[model samples]
Target: MRQLWRFGLEQAKSCIFAVVIFSALAITQFIEISFIHRYDFILIICLLTQLLMLTSKLETWDELKVICVFHLIGLALEIYKVHMGSWSYPEEAMSKVFGVPLYSGFMYASVASYLCQAWRRMDVQLMKWPPTWTVAILSAAIYFNFFTHHYIYDFRWIFKAATILLFFQTIVYFKVNQRTYKMPVVLSFALIGFFIWIAENIATFFGAWQYPGQSETWEIVHFSKISSWLLLVIVSFLIVAMLKHIKGKDNGNYV
Candidate 1:
């Protein structure tokens, strides 16, 4: 029973930031603050919440840098995707640029924040890690495909297969109290991707963004998007991996 409780507590601690962001999305939908755009209001809440987390030492400077990088990367993708008519923000907001709101970037930053928190809190380490050059090349291709798919044949399935081929031997070790547990790195990506898809559905329901089918009425996001999330998890994972791998090397604990 005590072990179970410890497990639950660790889970909550790792996920608290994501929970807060999702709750903010859900809560913003019901708020009728007339003094500002709803998107802007959410932006204020998210920024302030992030600041609070940092000030309270819940997040480190390195983690903040990772979150910021995701924010910029996500914002760039948002601009292009919105322009491509893949999805859109229907509401007007002062913080919007090229049809993408700044707060939308925070949504992506939240994912990076979760990863950073989870990595530290759980004492995660990688085993049989692929070469950094290989990871960089694959991650770059995965990110490029997100944009190129509209204009060219989508090679996401190929990339998906590559992820398995490359990392099948890789394991991620994480701590639970004095005990340690491990899982295949690919499984970690899939699990995180699944949860992100679930969160995406909730975000859409809360009017965070809308698909064309959802322009008139809210509906569940397509399950197929889970594959996209899986690929994106790879991208996000690679970025975080570089930082963790460096630390692991410095500590002489990883290959």
Candidate 2:
């Protein structure tokens, strides 16, 4: 068991070279002239790269069980939601098995970002008044999530419902700790959001999805992905909240 765990850790702990290459390819596509479809494997590459990077860090690998469960539940929920038009993607960017889009790849990346953040924030203290903090985090995340060049659409009620569901999921997952929680929770979400936004931009260029031509890209610094990171941050929180709930109930880390 220990050997297997160690091996998995190694797999998830590679370098960021793949992520860099993937992003470069993606941005290249978005910039090069012409309108032909571009094939991009950035998200998948990012997923694999993150997995290896994470596996190399056994501490992060410890969250694998939780990560797997989070993806399973999320894929199920998303499949249902997509059918209902709550959200969507390119018709077949993901493999479908048993009437569901195989979203484990995306979920894995999302989970990894949170795991990275949580691991980084482990030593901090939780706050007593987390509401203010949570809201502030939410506001920042929301702003960037929608404002970013990834795929900002104001489906108003659609997003509102999704955000509400995510917020409740947060409550269900995390304990109301008064100390050491703030930094870790917020930072974890922040990093996850960051990667997610980049992943979205990659997808847009790859033909996995696209924004309506009417929309204008929002520029922030040299890194236009800031806004998208904000939304990804929200996703990280939802996943963390769910994991916190499940793990707390079972008194186990993963399975």
Candidate 3:
């Protein structure tokens, strides 16, 4: 029981960036501001929150770089998806480009931030990790599928099968308190994806963005979105894992 409590504490700690961003979303929902658009306000808040995390030493410079990479990657996806009518940012904002608020990228960055913080705080390591080339190819395929699916036949299921086959032997070991715990890498992806799905519901409820179905009235995001999030989480994990591997190899401590 105590170990579970400690684990939860660490997970919450790892979500500091996400929590702050969500809080800003929730708070801005009720307050009216005339000077700045709500999306722009949220963007400013996110920027300040990130600056605080950096200045307080909660996030390192290298980790910030990784988070920035995710931001650009996410922004690109957001632009394409919105163009494809996947979803939309309805409100007007100075920071919007091609109908996506610039702040939207930070949402994706928050996911990377969580992974980076959790990996650090919980002393995470991977076992039976696949080769770099295979992982890179898989990551690229998964990412591009998010775009190409709109034009061509969606290969998500095939990619999902590939992910399972590739990482079937992989295990994640994370430390909690004085005890270390292990779980299958696939299971971790599913769990994180589930929570992110729940967060999506909350974000929509607060009017962060809207699906066509939600434009009339807010409703639960389709549960099927979990699979999408699962795939995304896998890509996020693979990127972070590869970075860890490279760093570890340099430091003579490859996991």
Which number leads on lDDT?
Answer: 3
Candidate with best TM-score: 3
lDDT of every predicted structure (CA atoms) = 0.89, 0.45, 0.94
- Of the candidates numbered 1 and 2, which has the greater lDDT value? 1
Q: How close to the true structure is residue 62 of candidate 3, measured as C-alpha lDDT?
A: 85
Off by over 4 Å in 2: 1-51, 86-88, 91-94, 98-108, 129-202, 211-235, 238-255
Question: Which residue window of length 10 is worst by lDDT in model 3?
Answer: 178-187
Q: Against the hidden reference, what TM-scores do the models get?
A: 0.96, 0.43, 0.99
Tens digit of per-residue lDDT, candidate 3, span 26-137: 9989988889999999999999999999999999998999999999999999999999899999999999999999999999999999999999999998999999999999
lDDT of 2 by residue, 114-201 (tens): 4544433332222332343455555445544443324555543454454554344332122222222133344445554566666656
RMSD of each: 1.4, 10.8, 0.7
Better of 2 and 3 by TM-score: 3
The TM-score between candidate 2 and the true structure equals: 0.43
lDDT string, candidate 1, 1-255, tens digits = 876788678767766667777787788788787898988888888889889899999999989999999999999999999999999999999999999989998888988988888888888888888999999999999999999999999999999999999999999998888789899999999999999999899889988899989998999999999999999889999899987788777988663
Q: Which pairs of residues have clashing backbones in candidate 1?
A: none
The local distance difference test score of model 3 is 0.94
